[model samples]
Target: MVFKKLLSAFGVGGPTVDTVLVNPNTRPGLALDGRVNLVGGDAPAAIEQIVVGLVTRVEMESGDGEYAGVMEFHRLPVSGAFELAPKQQLSIPFQLPVPWETPITDVYGQRLHGMTMGLRTEVAVARAVDKSDLDQVNVHPLPVQERILDAFARLGFRFKGADLERGHIRGVHQTLPFYQEIEFFAAPQYAQVINEVELTFVTSPQGIEVVLECDKRGGFLSAGHDVFGRYTVAHTDADRVDWVQVVDGWLQQTTSHYGGLRAQGFGAPQGFGAPPGYGAPHGYPTQHGHGGHGHGHGHGHGGHGRGVGMGGIVAGAALGAVGGMVAGEMIEDAVEGDFAEDWGFGGDEE
Candidate 1:
């Protein structure tokens, strides 16, 4: 997902830059390395600075309603005060730690439906700077994360869709202005209790804070409510983990947890992850659209927008009686504009 192009913003005859990341996918608390290659377009110019920033689109709550904005959470200064001569080619190598709370972009080498990430390059000339390239980054889950997901699948919970969310949960330590949400269809055993489920991860050095939102469907005998459950996990245990049993435990524990808000002893230590300290990031309030069966307004744009059938979990519900639902929030996949045709996500029933 790396993007390379001539530094067009600086005009013609400027240096062209291309960024190639070593490997796009890895678990949490790992390093993402790559090289930034620079080639003189016409002649070498004085290069003053090279900067890289991690950016993502997030939802924001406002007086009117929920909106989307890009949040640049982490930045690194690679090099400074360098010169490029005509026909000169230089590559700057970078090895940086992705924020412990960085969102997971893929699962088992597959796209997580609607998640998007980019590495933006900024080149400085003298005192001025030019935004150069945007490299689409693909990040996968940690081993433990994968195991939990596999358990859900094996238990018959189909993958729905995943996307970064804006804002913070009510009682969480947040540093960034957004979080990541992964939605899932209910497993057959729990179909009668919930229509769909939305998952969010807020990570820190200790581990990841897992937030689960169960969207209950209104029926003749019952109304609906959004049931939330939060938990944590350690990093080192990912390798030697019993993820299937652990995740199943979470589902079982949470499903039986009704009536009032529930918070359990799930947080664990995984050592320090980079710098800054332990705190979650972002702030996007869950928005709800009217008559919409499930979550919030952010759901549409949060993913690839509505037409894409972006969220697989909600779509899976449509395949069954307890299925077929309109996701209410997250702003990740649903769209209100002229929705485009869905591709890559759906075709025949799986």
Candidate 2:
């Protein structure tokens, strides 16, 4: 009994909780099935409520500068209230629905670089502090998302990294407070005009809104700047057309003289032919500048060389296999480090 009373915010004789996910791997618009196991401490405790939430690290802008912090985007109640006797045990099963716009942390079993997700379980006691548990969660891409990412790889875009920014796009519909940006180095073909590209997907039940930000290169007299493009695609068209050609066309249009029009806050040029079943391009006006808030932090575009491209390196392999192993280890370290220490929500209020 003494050993069972490991740790809790309700002092020594308080209940301890452990949340176990039946299957940690899931996709957007899906549900995560799990059970919460609780063991009563040496004394009887009045358990008030139980809750679970989805949390992730988001880079936010402050007056001083930008910093990364854990934010709980969604939460669900598991159990109402109960009274546990000493040495008693109880199990509560729950099904938490993943948001349609949830940022993907994994692709084809590979953890995306610079991304981390966790499911947090919090138990409230009547008159004592709360006890919480954290579990790592892997969110894979939807079918359409997978296809688009595959197209980028095939187009010779090398994966740089990915992170969530705390802000909204001026024209896109977003449910979550923050959005994710998957960064990539420009392919050899477009290297002369653009330095890199950042991809953002705003998904819903019917389809997705694809946003692209191209970092154009600076010439002798002019300084470089970012060009934006927004396009819509239906889920049904995921397999109806050749993605390579479609994506290539998008890059060409985005990096062309059309960028000059976007800089002036204009939509796609008239008579611009979009791919079959795809919506015409629109201008993406980020809240602040290039990356929503301000300059992107923690995303390093140096040291990594341009070579065989991401697709060639992981030919026939998983979608994000380019830096999967290293990213996996990095996620694990985060789970044990900052993620564990910072549960995001403090006390019984949240």
Candidate 3:
């Protein structure tokens, strides 16, 4: 009947799609294995295409302020146009290669707070509303990253929070459109000189560039300002040096340089043309027991929330409890709602 055609056009008789990942856990430069299971509905239909994309939340800077939304960084097409008979079932296997620069979502077997990742499936049919499915994904840190994080834990710095910032650092080689900042509160000894520290890692096939931003407290004579530091480490450097000492030295150098800058009349704070220390502050030792200079710091913008937590792991108890809730709602919208409309991916065919 004519009424039946109207109902089918509105998805009442369209195909349903479900994506199942064999293993949701993955790492950078790896492949995600999964299958798209489809069940045809009340009437035969023509499926325009089936696409699987890796989507995650990214914070972007706008005219007035910043806003966060889901973005599909990489996409893979599994199937093209196909005819589906009513009630027919089809299974399509796929292996999606995750990029080497994928932001990490889990650390030390625990989910990092303020991070979310998912796999989304988009199925477009001839005359029905498109349907999608989302699956949470876990991306673990690389070996070098793990060592540095564990070192932070060993150094008494507590994890605060993490977030993705849109923009590229001046001196770092960044492959992705954005970068991640993992923040931590200052330990007792450094508390008087600094408030918190934000750590960022820009990775590449050759090595990883580690950036540090230390927020210093104001002194009796000088105003407070953030100092930056950057360090480069090879993937093979894991287990080769004492990261605790290296990190400590970097922090010390970053904080120590303020006195010299202040004396040089580098008086203004951020946004007022304050001196951004591009290398180890002038006179601070840049080397550890091993030789080679660590990267220095400079001024930048934007960050996320902060909190207290146990050794190097981001505010564990509360973060572990609330992570699922945050990811659930955000990712649900990404897969179910208007993807193109929400993320400004205009003209990207479903």
Clashes of each: 41, 0, 5
Task: Report the CA-based lDDT of candidate 2 relative to the real structure.
Answer: 0.68
Tens-place lDDT per residue, model 3, 1-350, is 56655777898877889899988877676678899999998888789999998877666676767767666677899999999989899999999987777788777446677777778888888887777877777777765676677667666787887777766887666667778888888889899989998988877765577878888999999998988777677665654455566777767766787433322222111222222222222323222123333222211111211111123355353442111112122242544545334333221211
Candidates 1 and 3: which is better by lDDT? 3
All predictions: root-mean-square deviation over Cα? 13.8, 11.4, 12.0
List TM-scores for all candidates, in order: 0.68, 0.76, 0.76
Each model's lDDT: 0.56, 0.68, 0.66
> lDDT value for candidate 3?
0.66
Best by lDDT: 2
What is the per-residue lDDT of model 1 for residues 1-350, given as tens digits with 9 covering 90 to 100? 01112432345556777788776554445566788888864545678888776655554567877655445667788898787776698999997677767787755335666555666666665422343655666665643455456556656777777655666777777666667778888989889978888877777765577777778666798677776677776543443444445666666666564413654444433342332112111221111111212221222221321212233333433221000001123322221112111212111111
| Model 3 misplacement above 4 A | 258-312, 315-317, 320-333, 337-350
CA error at residue 347 for candidate 3, angstroms: 22
Model 1 TM-score (2 dp): 0.68
Clashing pairs in 2: none
